[model samples]
Target chain A: MATIATTPVLPATTRTRRGHAERPSAFGTAILLLGVVYCLLPVVWVVMASTKNGSELFSTFTFAPSTHLLDNIVELTQYRGGLFWLWMLNTAIYAGVGALVSSLVSALSGYVLAKFDFPGKGVVFGILLMGVLVPSVILAIPQYFLLAQIGLTNTYWSVLLPQLISPYGIYLARIYAAAAIPTDVVEAARTEGAGELTTFFRIAIPMMAPGLVTIFLFQFVAIWNNFLLPYIMLGDDHLFPITVGLSGLLNQGATVPALYTLVITGALLSIVPLIILFLALQRFWRVDLAAGAVKA
Target chain B: MRIAFKAGALAAVAALALTTAACSSPASTGDTDGASSDSGPVNLTYWAWAPNMDKVVDIWNKSHPDITVTVNKQDGGDAAVTKLLTAIKAGSGAPDLMQAEYQKIPTLVSAGALKDLSKLGAASTKSDFTAGAWNAVTLGSSAIYAVPQDTGPMMFYYRKDVFKKLGLKAPATWDDYAKAAEVIHKADPTQYLGTFSSGDPGWFAGLTQQAGASWWSISGQSWGVDIDSAASKKVASYWGGLVQKGVIDNDPMYTPAWNAALNDGKQVGWISAVWGPGVLAGNAGKTKGDWAAATLPQWTAGANANGNWGGSSTAVTAQSEHPQQAMQFIKWLNTDPTAVKALAQIANIYPADVHATDSALTTAPDFFSDQSDFYQVAAKASAAVQPFTYGPNVNVAYSAYTDAFAKAAQAKQQSQFLSALSSMQSTTTSDLKKSGFSVK
Candidate 1:
């Protein structure tokens, strides 16, 4: 979801910055306005819909805001003794720890692949890249089978373990490593008799900090937004991530309409944390850092 | 550089082949044989996914002192089956009993995952269920695999106020319904006497079955697909004519647009299953007390025959060691008067039991103006539904029909509908055959 949501903004924001550097063009402003509206429309709908009771959701005009926002939130919180909060916490644990570990693994792997001159180095990088092309969803069922064989499924470890080896993250880290971590600096660090591990942790890691953060942000959002894996893996509601929990609630809406209100309110609440995370991570965009690395 | 990259890529692809090694190998079901410990009271694990099911489970636990069953709520519908299939293939974590839609019974039976309940006295309880519901849970002659639960008998619900203004009485047959469509459309171009949703093929199937179209059947160890039968052709033309002529509104149901249309009285009534009343009340809250229900429009003069839409049943998995206790719980849950009454509140439908005389099905909903008896009409339809079977290919059939009908709705051609039906028929046949079933 973060990947998709951020896609249009990357190029658009770049264009806007150039426009500010020069003279603002009306055409550019119009396109920016269109993009803004396109991205915000669903959020606007969720806000308006969350303010409606079950019946008013369909009967009233879509944009009309009702007075039931608080009521809807109360109902959502009360659903199964505030199970919504549990789903949120489970998601945070999965995404938070999963992304942290994934970024480290990707960084170290990518660093080694990029800097080392070893046999089968290119093959390791190629296989990791090939892994990216194979859709993640295909891996989920087979992963389930593998995990179930060892009795690891239906546990937090099930979700966390599969997500930690993100092929795309490895690919991105490889790109960042080649571009940002110059071999010269690492060679110089090694000449000082520092251990290879110390050189990586002290020099290459600090230099690759922005890139790792970028990888972390991508992975965090990917695991946070994933629905199918958790839906297939976890049977216990207590272990459900927000996506599966909300989707189950949504399906129940076919029989119980009031659940629709809860789904809308829950959706509105779910985005708040991700939005804050994005806002906080704005400095990791690394356009300046990359430019400095290229100059060096 | 480029040559090394190419060789490296080849080697990587070769190395990656290890991941596919386990694809062919299936994991054995683990140590889940919990039903073997005798002497002590039997602890049964039941998996179900209906709303308010815990309340009913509590009632069952309270009544049966000797047998205590623990309920595990799993995702319902197809996801439930996927999980069950995985667990069954693994040979572990299979619940003692599970609830699934009746159409899914054949798939589980063919996979040899479901227990044949003939050994557990399911044969004696055949008369307790609606014949159609009973037929749904059974194989060729005797093997009853699941205990029938709630049923969704097809019925017609209408906005009584809109119909009264349009001088339209409850349609007794399809001909009268079409004629009413003409009247209503001529009076107000925006108004329709009835509607047909191309997206909901189950609704079409019910209508076709009402016209005596046996699209699916089972003979001696072989399945038959007759979706393009003459009766189905008649159903297509009858509804297709109304859809083409713009007499009946073709607004798709269960969407925001459809809800607005219903609230605006764009269609005088709706033809759907017993569950339609609850769905309508949920969607059309403003138009409450202005609606009523009648039996699905008959085909023959004063004749009575209908078709079911959605319902589910409880079946014991083959993994269960205590089939007798599982059967007792299933029968009690479905047939016990108190249990059925409790279930009615949870599912909000008529239980499959024909003899459970719960007056709730007869009471007029506040949304229906207290003028029309929704559940009583549904009960009549349930009794009239012929004992028909949905084969294992029903899911594949439904998806194919969905795509085909979406085209027919857009094309607005009877030939298109026939072509779609034929395509679905062939697909269902081949799919069933591919699954190692003898399909003719």
Candidate 2:
């Protein structure tokens, strides 16, 4: 009788497990789908609007696509003798260089804090935690004042320097490093006569490759989307990033009509590189998530 | 580890050296003054928002090689002023020249951002501009602050096709305008004569100006705010009654919805300024050759009075070391026949120079090709603008107007509109006093 009861309970548990696997929460999925539609609607609108010329933009249907995308791009490219392309180049330099250096600094700092038992390390981490709570927008005016004191307010360095030390990036790196890079590897490398910098660059850095890529991608997108810092720091349009440059096109003043078509097209073109970068680096994110699962 | 420490220390030293080098470089370049006997080429930077201003400066750059001006186009009036004020407070990084609006001159002067140009031969160009335009830069004082670049004299624009279809003539008085609005709305529920734009404080100020209202005045070191004066209240109530009666739409201008309204002929008229053609052509391109310009409907019949709207002036900043050269560039930019002509043609602005109408604006804009006398009507309206004074705290007043009127417009209440004016008056006066200005 006991064996028969146990056999019935086991089959019931299996049946419940299969049911859970086969069915999803309908209400939860409806909310999530609503959120997705809300997020994607504006992007779809921009894509559709960019294809319409100035005359057809407001008069036509909101979602109806037109054939003026190429014409709009050509006009935007010809604006002020191809100044929009210069803005794109400036954005690339700022985000590309800024993210690379930021990730390197974050990796070093985070790895040392995770592995090393240095004095005042708690104080340093506490300060970093506090910094993570402070919004970056509040820092722009003060950064502008500081840069002005050094006579570097309008230069490219003014924008690059302030973004290099993101506290949140370092914190993220710390969590990632503690989980990914084992201390045993560093000690083994040291026992093999590898120098401190040599071990960090060769052993720990390689072990933390997926994580560093995550940090790099995060910083890259942040710097790319940053507007207030560069807007306040740089005075010269030649030094302006795409965000500031596109804003200038729209706010040409009360008298002149805004360059709506060019701005819309520029916005669409600006997102293409971001999409490509995401697709390229998405594999790294997958590998990072799966690494711990494989170890378990 | 020791090698790493040494490398880091060396890098720190290098960064210090670089910063010092940068600090000294700007100081040396910024020290040279045009007042000095050095005939060296002066590189002046101008912060302006007018389109194709670079082309206008190209003309000057070719002729005056000694002082080459580079135009750094900025976002419109308020944003550029905020940036300029920040730079002025920093004691560096300000452009040599800025496009100052007439209302902002008082604020800029009070902040010591603008250099008084009267001592630098700006007085000679006074006769070139209208008296009302000149009065704005001077603040009713002896000190001249800016050169008038353009003026936006308020005018009435209506769709000729729509008016003809309805068998209605253009209204010449506010009473007639109300009757026409009722008739048009009764004929078609989707159509309206105009809209009450609460988002634009400048537009409201222009309407009040036509009613002989000066919102601000200064007398012997004291400021006066009269935002809720009888004249302003009259203008507000008139617009509010129309909105409440549902004859006019209580929507803001310069929005996508309004653009659509203008395009589809739901909005049949626009109470805009001389610069209206460019806006109409850009927004309602299909409606071209079907619109005509006339003077704003009179408060009293045959009054022939008008008000000013969007316009800007060129001012030299106090931080500029090359004030002399900066003054020369602005004078040429505003008054030179070729430069003013370029401003009208390429930049598409109504030049503030009194003689600009005689020479530069002989032809009508393409949008109003049907109305050949557009500029003539504009010039007549420009000559009739009443004098208005702007206080140092116009920004506070303007923002208060947006806040109070936005709610009133939403509620569609006439009493709320009048109360909005009182709120604006109190907000402006209190802010002036809070900022340590004596408000009476």
Candidate 3:
């Protein structure tokens, strides 16, 4: 049965690949190349700009590389006694812990909604869908007020707790759970004397591993790049994420010159972790695509 | 199924309980009283953007162990004020003190974000600052809202090499300034004397202040806005005429293009402030010794009138639990001889204290190393600044100026510039009325 399920997916994948290989449209290729350049030019500009010192930044050619990348990094690191690193660490904690906990919650709620029959389930899911429709930016001010009332506005929890319940993540998980976890498999685990929690942790989770990875990466990148929530919630520079910290460096008021070189260099360094994360988790995405094809 | 439902419900309740528990514990620990009991050491947080301010505060922290202050560096004026107002409205998380721009004082005070320093015995420091600087914080009232930290007495910065090559001297009058603008632009089409920056309403405000125009004034409980007064119109049309004739550039300052213009000497002059040297040295390092500072050109020849461009004051927040301690730190930060010297040397600000000249400012800033009497020119200009009052709707007026004059500057029309002033006046007055402040 497993062989039968897997065999058809192979031909479907190879056939699409062969079709693309045979008739590659020039127009389509050119459009995609345009998209690639559009996406990559700013990144290239950043990489080139980061290498220049303060004077060379404006004087030299826009794309020309210089020798001050290391020096710029040193200056940025030394700024206010390595405050850049503190912001980096703070960002990591917010994104890492926030995404991890959020994904787990998403998984639990998603599984229960997908596999069980319960009263008021539709209402719960509908409210979540409504939440997904509401932009998080609109909620930031209200969330700030809520956090302020509780005296948590400047704390890490102010940023963290508001992000713990991502409706879109839960919605994605629900859809993934319904598709990935077969009802028969859940029943078989129950018949084998597994409790619901044990069944979830053992059989269902392994089956939903690829989907959970997608949800985790989504939440991770979303929280990592989030600016407004943290900017509004936190006041202490020590607790600020990388986005807000770098912004402060650029806007040092009218009297002082902005640290343009440091900001550019900091921006370059900030993206390194995100790139590394994408590269590491990219294989799971490929696996997910193939798994979806087989299941279908 | 029932058990699963029960488990999920229990988890939700537990999560909520944990949040409230975490929140309530911190709430209880915070000091709620307005009075400074001073039972123990006071920990004050200050939001400021001046560079190396932490080092300046370090001296105070070392000497005054009982009331240690932490400086949380923030972004420049508008962002800091916006954050402060948000914190004030939220009823929590505001710092003990904030660095407020001179114009922002009225807005902050009207919002009740600031404590009246007059109540905190800050009135005694009045002699330390110039009348113009002092009046900005007091807003023509007895309530002292802030203590002036730095003053940006307006000055003209020109490239000495470029001026000499063009056979021009620093303009002594607005007419001479206009003639020089034409001469430079006629000599080199790529160059102009200076740009009309619609983006900076404060810079425009300063120019008008030099022309003896006060945009807003308080009488009784009402505000009288005269944004389009004769003095302001004279200042506006003067620049507009030059921009229309294509003798002056309409591009704004503090941009990358402007920085490049300063570096390569494509732009010969800048109408900047006392702290212009730091910006020049940072942006145009190649043209360091080539620049010179002079007083702003007068409307009438030999007149010594000037205006302020950018400056800030240290203000204690109304939400501060220990107002007395916060005021003490602010007083020391601005008026103390040791602290003022540190502000000049370490923070590189043009200290607002009149006594800053006697000891701290013995030498010129590095960019003006050749101009030995730089601060003397700045001091003269500082003393000459005419008092100008800012209203609670200065932000609305400023943004209106940007919108209206940006079009005027773009069209390069003298008429539009004059019309823009009227628009700013109307917008400002209407906004004041809408915000429940009586306007005359």
In CAPRI terms, model 1 is classed as: acceptable
Misplaced by over 4 Å in model 1 are A1-21, A114-119, A174-204, A252-259, A286-296, B1-36, B39-45, B62-76, B90-94, B319-325, B358-373
Query: Can you give the lDDT of residue B76 in candidate 2?
Result: 82
* CA lDDT scores, all candidates in order: 0.76, 0.86, 0.87
Considering only chain B, report the TM-score of model 2: 0.92
lDDT for position B254 in model 2: 83
| Pairs of residues at least 3 apart in sequence or in different chains that clash in candidate 2 | none
Instruction: For candidate 2, give the lDDT of residue A178.
Output: 85
Window of ten residues with lowest summed lDDT in model 2 chain B: B8-17
User: How many clashing residue pairs are found in candidate 1?
Assistant: 5
lDDT of 3 at A244: 90
> Residue by residue across B49-141, what tens digits does model 3's lDDT show?
888889999999999999999998887889889888888778788898999999998777666677767756899899999888898887766
Docking class of 2: acceptable
Worst 10 residues of 1 chain B by lDDT: B19-28
**B128-156, model 2: which lDDT tens digit per residue?**
99999999987877777799999999999
TM-score of the A chain in candidate 1?
0.88
